[model samples]
Target: MIELTLIGIGTGNPDHLTLQAVAAMRAADLILIPHKGADKDDLAGLRRAICDRYLGASTRVALFDMPQRDPGDPDYHHRVNRWHDRIAAIWQDRIAAELPLLSGKVALLVWGDPSLYDSTLRIAGRLELPLTTRVIPGITAIQALCAAHAIPLNRIGAPVQITTGRQLRDHGWPEAADTIVVMLDGESSFQTLRPEGVQIWWGAYLGMAEELLDHGPLPDAAPRIVATRAAARAAHGWIMDIYLLRRDRDQQAGRA
Candidate 1:
């Protein structure tokens, strides 16, 4: 009976951790951090930094190599499922080795809230062991993004859609959503949209020391964001970014 606790650490910022998240981390018997190779070593380092700050001297910490997703696979869902399966197997092995008796608390520090576009919960569901899962929620990238820009996520009485960059590129803006938040986009998918009457707020490394932000009408800001993102990714070797797009209903109506 392994009590697995997935604690959201939030956007690589130590201060973003909630009191509940700190309590859960301090209570864990073992904490597993995933190493995503050299390019993203800073990500693993951030987790280590958090553990160092929050955990007691007796708490155990382990690092596991993250399984890379197959980029060649045409079906995104199949590729991700296979990757998740591999990760689950790794988690099982690590837990068993780290805790031979396997009857204590195990923790994984997730980036952003586990409930929002994150797959930690989904991967945990695939574990073959007897497990009871607990989630400690933390700040989300959306929250951090909105905070950095000092803007609300949605207009009064209006809804906002959250989707991936792939969806935006493949399907264009959702017909029902006037505002959309795009995540997991390596490509500048906003380039695919018709820029007229649309505004965009883009940020990379949000809540981190290297944070960058740019916003304006889509047509004007797109070029600057592309340049900035390219330079930052080149300098850092890895980057996590998100953007918000909102269509001005009045401008659209005026055009119509």
Candidate 2:
């Protein structure tokens, strides 16, 4: 049976690796690295770096070409489903070819936590084979974002909405929640809001040496953050940034 282990490596920091992840890597019979091409990003290289640092020669390492998703497709959900299927097939092929026996453990180094804004689990589900799949949780960007800014996730008993930038752009702010954490946002979607009583805490390249952070009233901070994010992304060739938007209730009460 294919014993798959999804190992969370944390947000771009090698030191964030947990003991469980390290053990999984050491125990793995084969580790698959996804090659995401050169121009779009260097994440593939980061994955290799992690393996090179932690894995030994005994653990067979294989590189598989990652399929690119089609953004021009009319149906977004359908496109994602098709992309996941293709990825699952590729994983199966690569694993079977490298380790025909499939006797030992298999591991994948996941960026951040697999449960947060990642599709490794969904792809694994399509494996459709009887295999023991284990997930090792790691530090997520949300945690790193809060830590970098020295902010708490939720204020008192208030609720927070965790969403994508696309959703925020299309639906504005959700009335049901006082706070929101946005991920996978290419554009500065927060600017679409009225920005009356909102506070923003933003972070880029979280947990890394070149990390950037900014926080203040949304109206004042949003523009600077956008400029910084754009320039940083251009300089680094890619960027992973997340932000937390909170409405200060005490300030709201004062205004009222």
Total backbone clashes of model 1? 0
Across 156-244, the per-residue lDDT of candidate 2 in tens digits comes to 88888899999999998876678899999998899998787899999999988879999999999998999999899888888899999
lDDT of 2: 0.87
The whole-model lDDT of each prediction reads 0.94, 0.87
**What TM-score, computed on C-alpha atoms, does each candidate reach?**
0.97, 0.94
By summed lDDT, the worst window of 10 consecutive residues in model 1 runs over 247-256
Q: Which ten-residue region of model 2 has the weakest summed lDDT?
A: 247-256
In model 2, what are the clashing residue pairs, if there are any?
none
Candidate 2 is scored at a TM of 0.94
Instruction: Put down candidate 1 lDDT per residue, 100-210, tens digits, no spaces.
Output: 997999999999999999999999999989899999998999999999999999988887999999999999888667889999999999999889889999999999999
